[model samples]
Target: MKAAWLITIAPFAACEPVPTAERFIPDYRGVETMLLADDLVQFNVSMTNALSARDVENYAECAAAGYTLIRGWGFARHLRTNVDEEAGVWTADAVYTISPALPRGISTIDAEVVSAACAEKGIPTV
Candidate 1:
């Protein structure tokens, strides 16, 4: 019985002390304020393709000219193509985020130009 008791208590003896709440709490109010401001003035956009680095730069340039944000994703093709190609039917999708205040007409042109540029770079788009 004494040996059993020692075995149980030995584990607790080596436990580390818990930190106080003050040590873990962060100044989140500033972050929250920034997020709120961003919500008011940011736009969201995306593109789907399989373009190489040079192609991506071209797309980025188009996006910048139109005042938007952009990113890319990978998908499968009938045959292996770019670095991101997989075995099955997959595609790469690029995304962009921009401010909401920009003119709506330019946004459409932005999407067209970026999509075309990606295609020219060997990145397919639907």
Candidate 2:
């Protein structure tokens, strides 16, 4: 009797909704970039739904590469990235240094190549 009662109660329990394919793509607009200085720039990307750090980082890199090219540069080097979550919104604030030639840094990308890829993917830039 107790076993049957437990099974009946289990059916009535409130359960969280399982994640679906839609959740994988957060309600994120594209990337936003700001020119803080001639060589220094800031990038921000945010999503309404829950997202992982990797998603935000990907958004930032896409933005930086495209922005560098948009500014008539050929390379971009990562400076820093800040991640935060507020009231369900996840945000990543990233900074980068852009240059005509490859910057003297380990973390750098060929802006032309990356930006072209980003454009093909329909990612926005500043």
Best by TM-score: 2
9-93 in candidate 2: lDDT tens per residue? 8866747577788776556666777889999999988876545777667678888887787778899999999988888778899
Error of 1 at 67 (Å): 17
Q: Model 2: which residue pairs collide?
A: none
For every model shown, what is its TM-score relative to the native structure?
A: 0.20, 0.77
Off by over 4 Å in 2: 1-14, 119-123
TM-score of decoy 2 = 0.77
State how far residue 7 of model 2 sits from its true place (Å). 4.9
Clashes of each: 20, 0
Q: After superposition, how far is residue 23 of candidate 2 from its true place, in Å?
A: 1.2
- lDDT for model 1, please: 0.33
36-124: candidate 1 lDDT, tens digit per residue = 23212221222333233333333333433233322222111111112223432222223333343333433233444555575565433
All candidates' lDDT scores?
0.33, 0.80
Model 1 stretches astray by more than 4 angstroms: 1-109
